[model samples]
Target: MKNLNLKSLYRQIEREYEELRRLNKRELEERKKIVYAQIPEIKEIDDLIKGIGLASAKEQIMNPSSDSLERANEGIVELRTKKEELLKNAGYERSFLDKLNSCEKCKDTGVQEDGRRCSCMENRLSRELYNVSNLSYTLQRENFNTFDLGIFSREIHKEEGISPRENMDMILKISREFIDTFKINNDMNLLFYGPTGQGKTFMINCIAKELLDKNVNVVYQTAFTLCEVMEDQKFRRNEINDIKYRQLFNADLLIVDDLGIEVTNSFTAAGIFNIINKRLLGGKKTVISTNLSPNELTKTYTDRVTSRVFQKFYPIKFFGEDLRLK
Candidate 1:
């Protein structure tokens, strides 16, 4: 993905962290109040531990010495042990007063101690991106788990010289490979071209679902919607439109479905070429599914666009009875 407005995403995650920490601190304070009330001795131990920690910091700053630091550490440890014992005696868990974290690995911070983004942060960002792209409900129904190869005819597609079911099996294998090797810059792109009602869109959804689950940023939109974003970027600027426009080039995978269905003006053609060309130059993968054949696509789009489509993308042909009609 290009340098997507990830700063905005990080900022969002940061706000979530701030909220998490605030809630955690509030909960911890409540726990401390209960524990202190029930077991005054535990409160005394905690105060001593705090005092020792403060004194240790002062000593270390004023007269740094190994022996002094060791003594302060030992005192704090002993106080903590005594506090835990007191808590346990009072029928409270030893860790009842400890601040709880939503993610212990980062302690509610989106970034780890090493300054790398935490897994939780990545997961949160993935979900946020997925939500922004608005592809959950359709993906739920069209993903691989719901893909039924049994629906395709076993009889050979004479023009293609293979049974529809057999061709789909091959396509499925290729799609899985595409997903498996997505992280690698293998320069693999796919162009699904066939008549409407074939399994092209379904396969695209399957790939999108698999990649999205693995935290790969994917933007799936029809050619009409993609062109609409371009129009929005050029004419009516808004936050949502701007984000969607940026995502066209920034998402890890850009799937343009029903390509030839869009209004083919010079602006739309130029916009489509720009997206395809920019993504190609940036090493981002794209999947385009069209109801038009290669010849028809060439007639519809610019020669440069057709050239990139043919030269760069591996064409996957879908031919069968309309599975939807079944």
Candidate 2:
């Protein structure tokens, strides 16, 4: 399969990695300064630890005797005791040395043991390559943290037979469970269908955020953007497997938001079907949000596409007014 233009992505990811490293380094330095500023005497005590390490090394080499070893050991004792004093006086822990690992080993220099990649480098690179945003416009008033069930009316109970409040609460609960218990291959493809502002997209966004946080390679795209990528793959062929199609096909969680809202064409249908079919065959988890009802899905994409989705996906239908207006 084809992949992303790695040459372009590599440089971009590198730049992002560097920027993240700078941010981390600044934060670390600020924290260290805050810590050390309180204990100006740590300068003297730390100075002594370094002296002890060097002096012990030199003496052990030159003398290699019990007396020299004992004296060096005594110096080690004094150094540790001084560190303890510094900790107590500074109101800090004795393992203030543990605080030095902002980079965990390389001190944010980005080099690990024996010149291998450091933890900081790994984290930064991961952030760059992995931190993709589906809705970068900064979605407002919607987040997993603030999703409230009380908004759905209890009247929905008698009217819809399954109260909107109860149904939405169940959906929210199960979605959270699904995210927490997410497993590759075993995860079910989900179809969220309903009117606008019915919490379909918002709920999936919550799922996407949680799944991505688990380091799952996810693509959360508005259907328009999703169709564009599909068109790009089929027409211009500017992308590679690793970048677009493959990631979407194989992502632990793939969310196509506002499906059926895109401009419809043979290309769109084929592209969407291909994605759904491929993932279904592979047992990957996919999510599609749409305004179309079950019958409408059949009319739009034919029984072949609709059946594949119905049989393979856990169909979740959302109802009610655009909750956002409420």
Candidate 3:
């Protein structure tokens, strides 16, 4: 997994905290209104508590006598006790009128008073990773356990010597091992290339699901969509920071699907090369699934892009009948 961006995560947490506080305040005010409507005497109790508290503070500051201080403290405590009793008799707890935070430990602040991350913040970070992954809906159906190897033919091929089923079985094992040992082998990139419906996309989706379940950030984008976003970000008049551009390079795992089908131009060629080359240099993992052959890829993109791909990526050629047809 790539390193978690603590700064970004903390920013999100802060927003959540502010929202939570607003919600808690609203809930408390609404509940208090209802309670006051039911028992008008509750408002009197509140005023009494406040009056006694103010008088106690005035006495302590002006008089500074032990007897006066003790009597003031006693009077404040008596008023509070009377307030609680009135609330209880009206079938409401004293705390029911207070703003109730969603997280008691940190009061929905996402951090402790000692400046440590709260458990709720970790959960929020995991949820944020899922939201940005782009695979949340598809991962439900596309995972390693859901992959069907029976779609591949068991009959042997004369040239390859192995049946499609056997070849796919080997690929499946390799993919499983890759996910299992991802921590140590994170720099190992994968290139799944072959004809359409050969399970290239399925294999990459499986890898994504596995990593995402472990709270690893995975960015999935079709080649066409990715190019469009990059192009828009490049030409857009606004100077605001674009999240898509950042995730392209910063995500722990980037899966580019249908690589050869995008609209080809100078910008796309340079964008693809930059993404692949920079990710390689940063030791981030990437998976590319393409229907194009090696020659077709070289023709579609620049020689520099193809060279980096072939050199850095572990090429897995998928050769089987279309599983979608099956």
Which candidate number has the best TM-score? 1
Q: Write the per-residue lDDT of candidate 3 for residues 1-326, one digit (tens) a residue.
A: 13446577677679878998998999988987888788887778777767877887787888776466677678767876876788888777867765598888888888888898665665555445435444567877889888888778998967778998998998888888778877775678888888898888888888988987886667788888788658767886232225556667877778888888464677786787788788888888888888887777777765665576667887888886778887
**Tens-digit lDDT track for model 2 on 1-326?**
13435577656756755776677767757755776677767656667767877887888888777376677678878877886777767676776544343446775467767897554454444333434642433434456877888788766544568778878988887787678667845647788987788999889878876776666666677788778667666677653422565566756667888887354687777777788788887877788888987778777777466566666777787876568777
Question: Which pairs in model 1 have colliding backbones?
Answer: none
Better of 1 and 3 by lDDT: 1
Model 3 scores worst on lDDT over the 10 consecutive residues at 237-246
Question: Which prediction has the highest lDDT against the true structure?
Answer: 1
Regions more than 4 Å wrong, model 2 = 1-8, 12-141, 157-159, 240-242, 261-263
Least well predicted 10-residue stretch by lDDT in candidate 1: 125-134
TM-score of each: 0.67, 0.61, 0.61
Is 1 or 2 the stronger prediction by lDDT?
A: 1
Candidate 2 residue-wise lDDT at 200: 93
Task: Using TM-score, rank the candidates from best to worst.
Answer: 1, 3, 2
Model 1 regions more than 4 Å off: 1-15, 19-134
RMSD of each: 7.7, 7.5, 10.8
Error of 3 at 177 (Å): 2.1
